[model samples]
Target: MAEGGTTLEFTPTWVVAVVCSVIVIISLAVERLLHFAGKYLKKKDQKPLFEALQKIKEELMLLGFISLLLTVFQERINKICISENWLRNFMPCKKPSDDKDEGTTAHFQTFFSPPVLPATVGRRLLSEDSSAPTYCSIKGKVPLLSTTALHHLHIFIFVLAVVHVTFCALTILFGSIKIRQWKHWEDSAAQKNYNAEDVLQKKFTHVRDHDFIRNRFHGFGKSVAVLGWGHSFFKQFFGSVTKSDYITLRLGFVMTHCRGNPKFNFHKYMMRALEADFKKVVGISWYLWLFVVIFLLLNVAGWHTYFWIAFIPFTLLLAVGTKLEHIITQLAQEVAEKHVAVEGDLVVQPSDEHFWFNRPKLILFLIHIILFQNSFELAFFFWILVQYGFDSCIMGQVRYIIPRLVIGAFVQFLCSYSTLPLYAIVTQMGSSFKKAIFDQHIQEGLVGWARQAKKNKGLRKAANGNSAGSPPGAAAVQMTKVREEDALLRSQAKGTEIVTDQRSNSSS
Candidate 1:
């Protein structure tokens, strides 16, 4: 941790040392076994208590482990990463350093300023003199974010993730049981109040396509007034941490959307109408795969440290991709509703309004906004790389700068170009989906309207004619009123059924 001193050798021993000192694996196992045995001895009548107890146990166990981890690393990564320079760099408003360390004298507050490495956390850009030596320019202590808006945002995402995961897991467990119950009921197959297939489908579909973000956002918004600062407490408990599993939602969404795409990508017409649907999920898959691959490649290529650091972008791609995919699906679904029928639960989730608007101009505007966001993301990542490069550069540790840049540029070109394949598929998929739905829905509605109009004309004629055996005026009036009501009802029943039907199918 000194200039001109050998770099700190981080090894398994060092890692173990950094981890908690007291390992009580046997005691925890024994306690868990005893708890399980006690539950097994009890009758099933009091399951809710057991369930609640189990949940509490889980939470406590989690808190205990996390507390220990944080305590161990409190003097290392967290303190440094939360340093004033670090937070200010990523999070715009936070102070670079704290006013004073917690419960410390002004004399001793500065006592534990960890010796930072030569480079900062974020990367830099590649320009002229990029190879020039760089050093750890930043100094001083980090301020604890106790706490700020970014903390809230992080907390929000974390809580969202937890609730999302919990909901999903619950759906799977309970839903499977529900399906079996329905199946058992179906075996008897008499006067069944439940449509087993429909109910099952709805249950499964609901599980599959759970809207984690919108639900959490709405949940947060509703509770904001009542909870006051208490909201942050929940956020800290549930949202302060995120795991990669949050991605499982997006992968499912992509697959769900893929079900509706067109069938053929002919050798003759690779970009043909239906062929694009096949590629839509493929595009998303590429990014997901890219993240996995890049992380490993970096690790194997002697930049093992880069794996976790690069995860920020990988995690962003997974998370944001899921968020955006859901947004786009919803927008299309809404558009589907508007085209086929006027009476709709057309409440667009407000957070998604900007990105998921169906209007052409709105989409273009959104595209620009997304581009800017993407650029910022890339720039920040590049800066991270640059910062690392600068760490190596500043430390004068770079072995061969020019060669590294060439290889890096070449790799970036590949990464940047990766979109061509995904874009081709996504564009094809999105457009194909639009076209198919357009033809199947809007066009179908128009044709139905024409057919209905014709049928009404025939009915009117019949009503007016003597063969109907009713007064002409009364017959016409009744027919007209019935037709109007039918039309309205028919209009209200489009995406509502589809969403409901899909949810039922998947969750069941």
Candidate 2:
């Protein structure tokens, strides 16, 4: 060992490589085992099992990838730490230059300053111990991590991976349970021989009685009150007034007016419209928020070594985007419900085509602009991540990367609110949407409306051909009539079955 440097045992490169490889192999083996276990455990409801196993595999794969990167860049990372004078006390055989030492101190001071101050204060204070060896006092080559440290690191990572997998499995399991309950409820209602109107009335009663948002916030407020800052007031406020109450009040007129409308099943429509949204938006948001929490914990624990701090903007954008999307969707659904109530039916009106065609040009222009911005931002963020590794993002002379990222995310948010609207409008114009809407209308006793729309579509096509100097022949008109009769007959048969089922239940 050099002068002033203490002799230290270093983990060999081969040993590090072998350890990393073993970790990766073990992770892969665990993933495979989980796959088989999931298959054996839930052969019928394989979706939830598959989802849990997929998440576990992703977490383990990330761990394995990180371990591989650490092993591959071991020497490079050590050199960087030495040059930056990081972990100097831990690597006493490596000495940083005097100027670099001063720079390092300044760097830490800046790093520990406000915004990050609370998080790093303990580390800074620990570094200031007088008995700690000076940076320049160390001189020889020193491993940034010893064998024991490496083992501890691996164990920590493994534990975290296990915890993450467990959470993922639990979340999926709960979601699956909810799905199963919904299915069971639907089956039970069918077996009870409840007609559509009866089912709708029951659902409407439940919706009217339940204050979902209020109850949720009430519990949350109680949890906050336990923190003891007079948050009982918060709990009381949530208990008194819920957000769902506002929605109920706003739609009260529509609900009352449409209750007696046999042409429209407003309650059934509301339940169907919101059920999928609740599952998709709320479920996805729950998972994302949990991921964000886990990521923040890892950052605070220094597990990512400051590299993943750059991902904060993107992660936050994703979480906020999902939440905003959910809110906007709910608002749109409410507006649509009011419109349907005022119109007194769920029929696709002839005026709808004119309304869409005459939509403000500015709105269309804005849609394109928003879509472009979203696509560009997503593409740019991904490109940066792929092109510039974590070191480059955090420390490797990349100027203004973080600021640019922040700007991009801010711009994305400014335009992201239009995403759902644009998708809705575009899909509304699609054939699939038309088919689904018409089918739904038919089911809701609006078969005449669908028949008229189909007839109008055929007429428009025939008129187009006639305008091109190809007049429709008698045979073509007859064929169109035949097609219409066939569709109407099929719809009537479906309606007959529903009536027969209801009559049989009444008789029994």
Candidate 3:
């Protein structure tokens, strides 16, 4: 056993921090130095400086991969867990017992309870029980992972990965070389902007019938396809329907097959609708997907604490994507403008040709990115609360955290990835459901308040000396109207008297 093997330590955390910091510092320094050298070498050939930077980039990538391997497998390397029985003695007991000195549930509670660090640390060391038989060998206490079958399995997997990566690199190299050698390729080949349009169109378009049905065998459609088959097999139970019916149709059918239960599957429906809306209205810009993968990987690795650190990479990707998208869009517009300019009257709108949708994709893309990013942070916080127990924190409640997190995740998935059909369903359900969910009195009060607001607005306008005929002060400006009415009345009376005189003269 090593002399300092059982010492209290937080070495693993410190080592990871130091290694990462050193790697980052070295990489940045090299990149800056190369960039400065490139500026100086403008008079000289620029090829060497560019090559050096490229080599540095590749080296940095290898260094990062090695650092990651070390961080992940550090525990496997150290025999500390096996050698340190002193640390395990303080860990939570597997079960409760009657003995006071022996560790129990009570001991776990006492150790992890409120103000834990103060209460648990710096306890006087107790002597080991001499009456118990001691095991001299380490094998019984610590399982040897080197001899285990799992170690061989890990080695085999990594070997296969190395082969796969090497093959991919060779394929890319040969493909690039061949492309460069092709004669007049740039002049004869279809415009690069043409491919950009195809990409945007495919992203924005709904999945076609053939793709949707065929996709059932893929991981995504397994549940949906199975449900569709069950619905077809038991169509009579659900109620007899024509072959054309949407929900009961099988996997090969043109219609969308219903997957979840109709009553409780509002969230699923919402998600599908939301996805469709997102695709059509604000197509994904491609680069956001890369960041999403990065986020998921970090979360799985339990490195979610540094999730914010991803913002640096994400922002860079976003800026680059935006610039690329802008260039592609401008190129398309320029092509259109050139054709129109030849016609002498045709006008070309860049925006109309640039994006597939009326709204910008960036807005929706950012929204989803933000939501995905926050989910990891929230999941980590909940995990901590669950692992440490409720009494661990001053404001922690007795409720289970895991179940809450699961429900939260379910809701978050529905909210972010799908449209909320429940909102529309509730809206269509009308005033009764609204009254049940919200108070009828509150609704009435809101209505009354709205009416009063209109009245107040009119009064305010009148007080401000507005003389528009429709305003509240219109009655105050009716003196001329009243005078005109009186004059007309007197004229009618005079005409009646003249008609009477004419009738008497005719009778005589």
Against the true structure, whose lDDT is highest?
2
RMSD of every prediction:
24.9, 15.8, 26.7
For this target, which candidate reaches the highest TM-score against the unseen true structure?
Answer: 2
TM-score of each prediction: 0.22, 0.33, 0.20
Regions of model 2 farther than 4 Å from truth:
1-32, 81-159, 174-188, 191-508
Off by over 4 Å in 1: 1-304, 307-378, 381-412, 415-432, 436-479, 485-508
Ranking by TM-score: 2, 1, 3
lDDT of 1 by residue, 375-483 (tens): 3233323443432334322112244333333443332232222222222222322322343323234445556666776776777666667437877788878778758
Tens digits of per-residue lDDT for model 3, 6-29: 323534777778989999999789
Task: List per-prediction Cα lDDT, in the order shown.
Answer: 0.34, 0.37, 0.33
* Candidate 2 to truth, TM: 0.33
Model 2 lDDT tens row, 14-94: 877898999999968976898787787456543433444555556667777868876676445434323333443322111
Give the 10-residue window scoring lowest on summed lDDT in candidate 2: 107-116
Please give the lDDT score at residue 226 for candidate 1: 46
TM-score of 3: 0.20
